[model samples]
Structures are given as C-alpha cells and as structure tokens.
Target: MKRQIIASINHNLGRAIALLDVIDSKTYQDTSIGPYYSSIGSHIRHTLDFFDCIISGLDTNDIDLTARKRDEVISTDKDAAKDHIYKIQETLTSYTDVNTDYLIHVTDNMGQGKITVNYTLESILAHANSHAIHHYATIGYMLEQLGVSIKIPGFGYNPTTPVNKREGI
Candidate 1:
C-alpha cells in the first residue's frame, strides 16, 4: 500500500513538472513571488512547502511548522521550481516507498486545542496530491491571464473525458 501510494505522489509531482514545462520560462520567472493567496507562484511554492514538511513530518512530529509558511513563495525562477520538484521527488521516493507500517502524526496548525490524529504515512501523501491539483489549477489560470496555454496531459484525459471514455453504444 505504501509503495503504491508513494508512486502516485511521485507521478503527480512529475505531471506538475511536465505541465509547467509547457508554460514559458520567462513568464515563470517574471511572475510575482509572494506569500499571498492571490498569487499563483505562491500557491505552487506552497505546494512544495507541504511536500517538504510531509516528507519530514512522517518521522518527527516535533517540527516547528506552520501551514501559512508553506503557502509563501520561495522563488519565482523556473530553475528553482525545477530544483524543488527534483529534491522533493527524491525525498518522497527515498522515504515513503520504504516505510510500510510507519505512523504519521496529524494536527491542526499552531496547537489550536484540536485533537491530533495518528495516521499511516500514506494519508499525508494523499493530502499533498490534493494540494497539487489545486495549485495546478491556479497555475493554469495564471497562464491564461498571461495569454499562455499549457498542453497539460491529464486535463483532458480524465475519467469522464472522451479520451478516457469507451464506446458502449
């Protein structure tokens, strides 16, 4: 189960790299570097931030972390983004794939008097997958605003799309 789930996480990370490759490098660099939710690049950085945290948090429950910090943009340079993607992929593949019965500790940010839950590491992996989708949509919107379009692979071949649909009639 852990191996299968970890593979899915890495695959999503690969898709992000492929889709972003379709976007212009200059635009990727010139886009705003921000901590605000209004910025697209910030969202992408935010996704990577959690990727790092989850990778780390899988082992230690004591990392000083905040969700907002993950949302802040680290860099606008496409190379930086690519570097992050590669590093995070390395971490995910190196760690998650090997741990089968490892436990993950989950809690609300900032110790807000909420009960913490113990989950298998794969649940956190799924959270990152969901976040990647949201940020990918954000990037897709930002590209549209810049009059740039990415020929992303999964956007049209979804389960309901014609490319994925089969003839039954």
Candidate 2:
C-alpha cells in the first residue's frame, strides 16, 4: 500500500514536470481563458502547495493546509515550478519508511472557520494525490483551450478510472 501510494504521488508529479517541459512560459502563465480563467501554472502551483504543506508538516505532525507557502514564483515561472516539483518528488521518495498509521492533525478552513481534524499520514497523502489529479484535469482543459497538445499519458486521469479508458491504454 505504501509503495502504491508513493507511486501515485510520483506519477502525478512527473506529469507536472512533463507539462512544464512541453509548454512555453507564456502558455503556462496565460489567463486569457473565460470562466474560471486560471492558468496551467496556477493549477500546478496549487497542487504542489498542498503536497508541500503535507511534507513540511510531517515531522511536526501538524499539517496545516491554511498555512501554505503559496509561492508566487511557482505560479508564474515554469522553471521554478519544475524545480519545486522535483523537490517534492525527492521528498516523497524519502518517506518510504514513514509510519502511515501514525495519526496527525490537519488544519484547514471549512466555511465556518478553521478546523483541525485528526488523520493518519496515509489518508492525508492519499487526499493529496487525488487533489493533484483533479487540478491536472483542469489544466488539461486549459491546455485544450490554448490548443497545446501534450503527449504525456495519464496527466489528468483519476486512479479509479478504468485502465481501458485511459489514454494510450
């Protein structure tokens, strides 16, 4: 289970790196699209920020989502985002011996106000993986609008998606 979870995290992070590699800086930071109007860089930064929060808090056992670093350079610079992604990939790899059963507190805003809930490290990591995929899907839509075709497979697919339904399956 630990190996599977780590693999999923690395897989999504790899897609983020691939996205940076394929898209130019202008396309990455563009916000000309209608509706939500979020850029691919924004989605990538947001996804990485969540993972950063979890990893940074692991030793302290106080995973505070509300206190995200929210690095602006990552949102506007493809190189910086890729650098951060690589750092996260390295961090995830180092956690192979983590005690997933250990309970930790995750603090986040929930409409009413801030709330801290007890969660296992395993559960929080799983949520982070799913969140990355969700943001990747939005990035995929943005890429479509920009007419940039990325060749990386499974960039935006949920793990639960049937194997036959995924691209290049």
Alpha-carbon lDDT, every model: 0.62, 0.85
TM values, all candidates = 0.73, 0.93
RMSD of 1: 5.3
Model 2: lowest-lDDT 10 consecutive positions: 160-169
**Worst 10-residue stretch by lDDT in candidate 1?**
62-71
Candidate 1 wrongly placed segments (more than 4 Å): 29-37, 62-73, 100-102, 110-115, 155-169
Point out where model 2 deviates above 4 Å: none
Q: Write the per-residue lDDT of candidate 1 for residues 92-166, one digit (tens) a residue.
A: 778644644856676655456645666667777776677777676666666666677666566312224475452
In model 1, state the lDDT of residue 165.
Answer: 52
**What's each prediction's clash count?**
0, 0
